[model samples]
Target: NVMNVIISKKSGQPTTMKLNGVVSTSYSDSAFKFNKDFAISTDTTTFTLEVTWRMIDAEDGSAYDSTDTNSFKIVRSTRVNQPSEGYLDCWERDLFLQFNGKPINAINETMNKLEVVFTTNSDRYKKVSVDITHKSGSTKDSLLALPLSENDSGFSGFFEREVGAPKRDNVLQHSDPDSIILIYRNPDNPLDTIRKAYPFAISKILKFPAASYFDKNADGKVDSIFIEVEGPVDQEDLEKLKSSITLPEPRKFKVNSISVVKGGIALDVTEQSNEIRTYVSPTDKIIVNSGSLPAGGLIEGNIINVQDKVAPVLLSGTFFSDRQDSLQVEFSEPVKHFSSKEPILFSHGGKTYRVELAENGVFSKERFYTSKVISVESGSAITEGDLIWINPAAGIGDTLGIKQLNPENRRVPLKVQEAEYEITVRTVNNPMKPDKPVPPEVVNVFGEKGKKVPPNGVVIVVEPKGEIKNKIKMDEGKVSIYDVVKHLVKKDIEGVFDEGTQKLYFIWDGTNEKKRVVGTGTYNAVIRATTISQKTNNRKTFSQIVPLGVKRK
Candidate 1:
């Protein structure tokens, strides 16, 4: 008899196998086998066994030959499987095993029990068992043994004890091991048991702090917020963190940047396009969806707070009274350290005046805080086209002690109005007809026709009309009657300025200062009045001259 065993892979190793065995007629019914001491290479899983034998009669040399071939697979060893790494199920808040070669049967709440169903073709093993073990210094300690039961595909069971802790120091602990020892036992031969250990690790979710705040401008309000998290976050984790934030309805925050800060990762939060900077208030609560995070951890909400560090601003200054002597200064917020001695500057008629606040004038009204009605001295009246501004050198401040520094804040252009005046002259008809009516005419002392006047006299009237209700001065020498031919002053008329009527009345009567009628071939009447121009704050003199003709009766 001849027998040959061939290994499927024979590139670099021996393929044929030789066996020492014997077969006899006395044991014709028995099977021939190789010696138990013979060993087969375990480098390959498939092998082929072939046997050839010849039979001959007792008297003849004739022979009958037959060959039989059989193929089979070898069980190398028991293994846990490939891809032994474990993952953190953040949504479930549990450590999940990612096994590629086996199907998961069940997982208990305590995470101590794990059942896996494996498929196999061999029937030599009677039962399967697993040992959950970890290295304790130099020795390996078996935490628990899971004896599996017979199933459709293979054996599956659960461990009786827990495997890992609820939390870990780091998010991923690659150094630690939570491995499984797969064991395959043969009932026929206990010494042929197979056991193998596969090492793996369990990663836990990352946790972050619960409080953050941002005051970029250091103002008394919150400009933005910072949400801290673990560092070295990739783009995928960044998008997840952004979607996990929750704010109140209509109030939204955007992630401006993800940067590595001194402590950890920082998510800078700012306002959206439609939102304002002050959308996040002090002591506001923000919910973080822990399930959406990459790793599993506790849901510690973020608490935001606002801090103030910016000074107040002076907004504008305006004249509150029609007289243009009272200025109202406004501030962006409530201010302090402003008193009656606060030096405020005013620009009027190309001149600068240092003014002070009126008594009890520091008060707030309307929407903004105001230094109400600062009274300018009568001699330095601020009027139309004037300017009033508060300089930073004035040392004004808000309640928080932040000083005002912007010069444009309190600068205001005043629009106070000034008074307007008109002059009219009334002359009598010819002296022969005291009650007769005569036609009125315009006369210019510079050579225009003069208005005919009777010996009785002529009356000059000046009317002041404007927003200003105060009376103007119209004293003697303000209205002068002179002789046009001689170019000499004939008389200085005295006029009465009436505050009630806002008018100045002067009766010339064609007479000289000696109270006598003067010859009036062509007498000139000059009227001069002084007024302050509100635009330039400059004193201006207005003059009007009229020539009169004296008619004989």
Candidate 2:
């Protein structure tokens, strides 16, 4: 706030002047009566100031300087007659949205609440509007939606509060739907010290959906989000964001070598004597290299390349021997065997550690935990509080992955903790005593018992759920076809049946156009018999020949 010290004069006019907090002498014609309500007291006012967010290189939402010329003014009155830097300016309120522990940028950012805070510099406080913009772009396009795991400050947005109306303290949550690594900071927690130092290593990661993003240049398109201090940012004069939001740094391991020894992947092994050395391939495969002479080496398996890690096995004091040298090294504990990244089990306490080879062929652990691979030893040296990790070379075996080892100290387990089962599947199957047909009882009479008409006439009646639909043939001479089967597909059968008694009548207006067939040769009238289903597909047939005698007048 640049105060233009106004003094009492005959005329009432306000003046403007530049302020560097170093004004030596000043005089004005108008007396400036300050609004003591929100103004600084001349005697005991503190020079405390705050901004909603840090300013970006090319943005206008934060503080501005006189260098821009087109800057706004901060309105505040003076109550105390004090020194150079005792001024307060605050006016408009802002809506802050964050995820994990960072502020949201752009519009439509996953907002839990419209956080309100502001600089008193703007004259348009009473009337202010904001846009919550969330947009996602790729590297080729201008990445706006930052990934969750990328650990950094300044340019990454995080969640620090729950997504809803504002409150002093609630369960902090991700304002946007993007995945976030939550690292809580409670000033009064017993584990507060451990939470801040290695925060990324302590907290968990979760992915959600949110529409929050920012367009750094304000081109009407939200391009990215500024990930603020999700946690205590390193006290640096300047801090930067991670290289890429999508790809986070891979974990690391420290061991003498990575190889597929006698045991399978990521397993651990120890030398029996000082007569053998182990050779590990870049692919994480282990092999017994040339050594003096040795047999009977204790081998422990390792399974690495995991999304989550626990600890490795426990090798109850095993020794390594290259055969050439007699000095045998040793380790107190063994590594672990795990099923997958889910952490099924651990050899000892940390025996269930997972391993992930360098995805880009880079990444390593501290040298203190790294073994130099000296003479054959009974065990490797691993210290407490040490974050050990392993890295595999590129283009090695098993598609470029790292070999991890653990302590199998607790006597190879049965792989299962607790078991429970049910008889849902009918554990006992006794030949499935053949299924009985439906309708316990059915009457069976070969032919109809009502009437016996000449088999020469075609029968037409509503279809019944029986095997008598079509297999009834006219029995002309040898070949015969039923009216239903003949008209259904394209087939011609000669001879004629008595359109008798009108039981089955032919509704026709004129005589046959394709000529008549009142013949003497044997005409086949084949009908089909079907199952109770009434489907033509469920039918079979029988044939009978009938001799035609023209009304022997």
Tell me the alpha-carbon RMSD of every candidate: 22.0, 32.7
The clash numbers for all candidates, in the given order, read: 5, 127
For model 1, how does the per-residue alpha-carbon lDDT over 128-204 read when each residue is reduced to its tens digit? 55444432223334533456677765566554333344222211111243444444434554333344444543333
Candidate 1's C-alpha runs over 4 A off are: 1-223, 228-236, 248-258, 263-283, 295-299, 302-361, 365-368, 372-553
TM-score of the candidate numbered 2?
0.15
User: Model 1 residue 54 lDDT?
Assistant: 49
What lDDT tens digits, residue by residue, belong to model 2 across residues 1-553?
Answer: 1322111111122233223222223322211232234454544444322111122333553432222112233434565344485543333322333433444442222233333222133333233222122111111111122222212221223323232332344333222332222222113321221100101111211111111122222212212322222222221211111211221112111122222212121212122232211122233221222111111111112222222122122122211112211111121112221122211121224443332211222112210111122221123222222232221111111111213332221232221111111111010111111122111111011012222232122221212232222222222212232232233211333222222211111111111234343322222233322221111112223233222211111
Q: Report lDDT per candidate.
A: 0.47, 0.23
Stretches > 4 Å off in candidate 2: 1-18, 21-95, 98-128, 131-277, 285-553
| TM-score of predicted structure 1 | 0.37
Q: Evaluate model 2: give its lDDT.
A: 0.23
Worst window of 10 by summed lDDT in candidate 1: 1-10
Query: Which structure among the candidates has the greatest TM-score?
Result: 1
